[model samples]
Target: MFDFIKTQVIGVTTPTVDFIPTAEDLPAFCARVSNPDNQKNFDTAAGLLKYCMRVGHWSVFDMSNIVIEIEAPRDIARQVLRHSSIKFQEFSQRYAVAQNFVIREARLQDTKNRQNSIDTENNYLQEAWKLKQEQVLNLVRENYQWALDSGIAKECARVILPEGNTMSYMYANGTVRQWITYLKVRDDLGVTQKEHVDLARKIKPAIIAHFPFLEELMEK
Candidate 1:
C-alpha cells in the first residue's frame, strides 16, 4: 500500500514593477539597430545582440528580472533549475527539523484558497489520487533516508525523488522577458490559473512603456 514519492508547489513570484525606459529612447534604440552606420561605431557583436533582443526576436528577456518564490515539488525543482542562468534559493527541510512541513493535495483542496491543489478542473480524483500521492511521497522520503543511513551521501540519496517534492526559490532579475514568453505559451490554452494571467497582464503594461511598438503589437 506504500509506494512513496513526494511533491508539492512551494513557491510563487512577484515582479519588481518600477523602472520605465523613455519613449524617445525606444525610437532611437530602433534606429540604432536599424542603421548599420550607427551600429558600426559601437561594439559590433554586442550591438547586434542587443538589437535582436529589443524587438523580442529572441530571448532578450534574460536582461530583466521577475523574482517568484515557487513552491515547487523537488521533482519540479530539478526540472526548473535546468535553466542554468537563473538563480535559486530554497528552504532546507533537512536542516529545519521543527516545522510541520507535511502537506497533502487533499488537505489543500478543502481550503479557502484552492490554489494549493492542481487546477485539474474535470478530472476528479475522489480517493485514488490522495492515496497515490501519499505513496509517492512516502517512498521518496523513506528511500532517501534509507540511502543516507546506509552510507550513501544525502546528495546521492536524492536521485529517486520525483517532481512533486516541493521547494522554494527566487528567480531573480532578468527573468521578465522569459516571463513574456511564459505568458504567451501558458495563456494559449485558457487553462492557466487566474493568478498567473493577472501577473502577465500587469507586467506587460509596465514593460510596454519601455518598448512602445512592442506594446502596440502585443496589446493589440
Candidate 2:
C-alpha cells in the first residue's frame, strides 16, 4: 500500500545569486571623470556615488557593470528575464536533462488581489496537498525518463517538464542602475512572488559586499 501519510515532502532548492568579481571601482572611477574638478581619492569617489544616487543621476551607475550567476526554478527564472536591462544566458534544456523540481507549500489564493496569495491555516489540507504534489512530480519524473528511454529528443521530451524544474544562468550581466531597479521592484514582498523576493534578498548582500559604497542607496 502506498504510504501517503508517511511520504517525505520534497522542497525547493534554495536559489543562489553570486557576484562574479570584476572592476569593482569602475563605477566610482567613471563618476569621478564626469566632474574633472573632483579629487582623485576614495572618499571623493564614495561621496560622488552617494550624491548621484541621491539626486537620481543614474547614468553614472551605468559606467560600471556586475555579473552574476543565478540558480532558480524555471518560473522564477522567467521572472528574472523580464528585466529588459539584464543580459542573460540561461541553461539549455534542449541539450541537458532537466532534473531539479521545486515543491512548495500550497497557499490559498487571495480574494482581493489577483496576484497575491494568503497562507492556509489548515494543516491537514497542507499535508494532503504536499502528498499530491509529490505524487504528481514522481509521475512527471517517470514519464520524462520513459521518453528518454524511448529515444525521444531531449528538446521534445523537455516540453513535458513542469515550470518548477530548476534552471541556471551562468552569466547574467547588468549595470548598477539596472540591478538597483531590479532589486527595488522584486524585493517588495507586497507585490512580488515570495520565492523571487527571497532570491532578490540573496542578491542584495552580494552587491553590498562587493561595492560597499552602494549600501546606503540599496537601503533606499
Candidate 3:
C-alpha cells in the first residue's frame, strides 16, 4: 500500500543562500538592477526582496528556480499539474507497469463545499470503505497483471486502473515565484485536496532549507 508521501529537492539554482551576494541572490539582484540608485549590500538585497514581495513585484522571484521529485497518487499528481506554469515529467503508466497504489482512510464528502471532505467518526463506514477500496484495488491489479501476461499493450491495459490505483513519481520544475504561487493555492488556501495539502507540506521544508529567504513568502 502506498500510504506515504515522499518529496525530494533534486535541483536548485543555488545550494546555499546567505547574506553575501552571489548567484544565490538572483531575486534580490534582479530587484537591485531595476534601479540605478540601489547599492550593493546584503541589507539592500534583503530589503529589495522584501519590498518586491510586498509591492506585488513577483517577477523578480522568477530569477531563481527549484526542481522537486514528488511521489504521490495519480489524482494528487493531476492537481499539481493544474498549475500550468510549472513544468513536469511524470512516470508513464503507458510505458511501465504500476507497482503500488495509494489507499487511505475515507472521509465524508463535504456538502457545504463540494470540493472538500470532512473526517467522520463512523467506524462502520470507515471499515466498509477500506474493505471495498482494498478489494477493488487488488482486483484491478490482478487484471492489469493478467493483461500484461497476455501480451496486451501497457498503454491499453492501463485504462482499467482508477486514479487512486497508481502511484506516480513526478519531477516538477518551476521558478521560485511559481513555487510560491503553487504552494499558496495548494497549502495555504484551505481548499485543496487533503492529500495534496500534505504533499505541499512535505515540499515546503525542502525548498526552505535551500532558500531560507522564501520561508515567509510561502506562508499565510
Candidate 4:
C-alpha cells in the first residue's frame, strides 16, 4: 500500500572474512581460519563469517560497504536524516528545483497510540483529500515558479513550499556495521513511521547478499 517510498542500493562492495583484506585477499584468509592446526574447522568463507557474527564482533562488519539512494517526501527524509552516524548528501532546494510532491492521503491518528496512524474508514473521503492536496500543491508549484520567474532567489523562494509536500532525495554511504545499528531501530515494529520500516525491510536482503550470516547476527 505504501508506494511513495522509493529507494535503491548502488555501487555495493562488501568485504570478505578478513577485516582489512582486499577483494583478492579473502580466500587465503578463510583458508587460514579453516587450517587443520587451528582446528577452527571453518570449511568456507561463509562459515568463518558465521563465527565472526556469533562471537558478537561487529568491527568485522565494517568491511562491508554500500551506498543507498532514497527518494522520499520531506517528512520521511527528515526521519532518515536523524541517523547521524551515516554520511548523507541530500538534494538541496537552495540549489535545485523544488519538486513539491504532495502526499495526498490523510492518515487517521490513533488515540491510544500516539504518533501512529490507522486507516480511515471512508475511501471516498480519502479520495477527496487527495484531490484537495493536489489542488494545494498545484498552487504552491505555480507560486514557486512565479517567484523564480520574477527574479527571486531559489533559496528564498523555496520558503513557500510546505515541508510535507516537498520531495528530497539523499545518498546514504556507510559500512554494514553502521547499517546494522540503523536497521535495528528503524526496522522495529515499534517505530511510529512505517515508511522507515518499509525501507529497512527492502534493503535488508541486499545486505544479506554480501554478509550471508547477517540475519543470524541481527538475531543475536
Candidate 5:
C-alpha cells in the first residue's frame, strides 16, 4: 500500500498549479489597483497599470499575489533555488523515500562549447542513451530499496539517488515583481537545463493571466 501511494504521488509529468485566477477573477484585482485607498485618487484610466510597471513603480505590482507549485527534476530544482524572492517547499529525500526518477533522451554534447548542447535528433543515439539511463536508474532503485528493506536510514539510503531524480517543488505566494525576476533569468535560452526553461514557459501563462503588464517585461 505504501509503495502504491508513493508511485501514485511521484510518477506523473503534468505540472499542477492551484488557485491561479480565472478570467473572471482578474477584474477584482484590476479594481483593487484602480482604487487602492477607496478614495479613487487615480483616475484608474486605461494603461495605468502598464505605465506603473514600466516606470518601476512596483508597489502596485506587489499587490498581485499568486501561488504555484512545480514538480521538477532535481537538476532543474537546484537552479530554481537561486531565486531568493519566491518562498519554496520541496520534497525531502532525507525524510521520505524517492519513488520516481527523471530520465530524458540525452542531447548531443556541443563540441564547440563545453558548456552547451545540441539537439540529438538521431533516433539510434536517442534510443541507446535512453536505454542506458533506464538501466542505470533501475540498478539505483533496486539498491536503494534493498537498503531500505535492510533497515538503513532513509537519509543515508537517499545518497544512492542521482541528481536527475524527480521532486515535488512548491513555490508559494509570489508577487508580480518577484515573478518577473524569476521568469527573466530562468526562461533565458542559455539556461543549463532544458527542464528549467520548459517549466518556466509552462508557468508563464498563469503569471500573465493575473498581471498582463508583465507581458511587456517578458518580451524584453
Candidate 6:
C-alpha cells in the first residue's frame, strides 16, 4: 500500500521566458484588443487576455520549474522514464536490496491515478499488496544470501527477481508549461492516475496565476 507519502525534490532547472506577443502588431492586436464580451479596457492586460482567448499567445509560460521524487514498481519505472525532456534517475532493482527500499503506506488506492490497483474498502488491497511486497522482499533476501554462500555472481542470481520490486526516482520538470500540458492530458479520463490528477489539480492554480494566458481557458 502506498500511503500519502512525502516526495522529496532532488533537482530542478527551468528556462526563462520573455514574451513578445505576435498580436502586438497593428491589425491582429486591434482585432483581439478587447474582451469583445467585456468591451471596456484597451490596455496590455485586457488585450493580452483577449488575444490569449483568441490566438493563444501563451509563449511567456515557458518559464517555470518542478521536480518530484517517486517510488513505484520497476514495472512502472520502465514506462515513466520515456518523456524526453524530463531529467530522470531511477533505482536499479537488481543491484539494490529491497530492504533498503522505502514502502509507501497508501490509505486509498486510486486506480484512476496511474492505472494502479486500489483499495476502497478498509484498505484491503493496500494490505494485500504490502504482504506481497514483504514476500518478494523476503525472497530477495533469501536468494541473495544463498547466492553469496554458493559463490554465484550477484548479477546472475538476481535475474529471477519479480517485476513488482520497488524503485525510487527523481524527475525534474524543466518547464511548468510542459507540466501544465501534461496535467491537461493526464488528468483527463482514460489517461490519468487519480493521485496524479489530484497533484495536477493542486498545481493548476499557481500555474494560472503565473501565466495568465493559461488561466482563462482553465477557468472556463
Candidate 6 deviates by what RMSD? Answer: 7.9
Candidate 2 stretches greater than 4 Å from native: 1-24, 37-39, 165-170
Candidate 2 structure quality by residue, lDDT tens digits, 1-220: 1111111111111213232123445566566675656524555566777888889988988876677777777788888899978888788989998876766667788888867878787989888987887888898899999999999999999888878644444456887788889989998885898778878887787777666777877777
Model with the higher TM-score, candidate 1 or 2: 2
Ranking by TM-score: 3, 2, 4, 5, 6, 1
lDDT of 5 by residue, 1-220 (tens): 0111111111111113333233222332454555566423233422566666677776655555567777676776787777868766778888888897766756777787776677766989878977888898899989999999999999999888887755555554566567677777777655455567777777787666655555765777
| TM-score for candidate 5 | 0.76
Model 5, backbone clash pairs (residues 3+ apart or across chains), number: 0
Error of 5 at 109 (Å): 2.8
List candidate 3 stretches off by more than 4 Å.
1-3, 15-24, 34-40
lDDT per residue, candidate 1, 48-154, as tens digits? 44456556556443444445545434443454455555566666544432111233343224265444334443435536676686677777777776777798765
Q: Model 3: number of clashes?
A: 0
lDDT of 5: 0.63
Better of 3 and 4 by lDDT: 3
Number of clashing pairs, model 4?
Answer: 0
State residue 96's C-alpha deviation in candidate 6, in Å: 5.3
9-106 in candidate 4: lDDT tens per residue? 77566343455344312432533544646433334556666666566666666665678888888887898889888889999988988864856466
Best by TM-score: 3
Which RMSD values do the candidates have, in order? 10.6, 8.0, 2.8, 4.2, 7.4, 7.9
Estimated TM-score for each candidate:
0.43, 0.84, 0.89, 0.80, 0.76, 0.53
RMSD of candidate 1 to the truth, in angstroms, is 10.6
**lDDT for 159 (candidate 3):** 95
Over 4 Å off in model 1, which ranges?
Answer: 1-64, 78-124, 168-172, 190-220
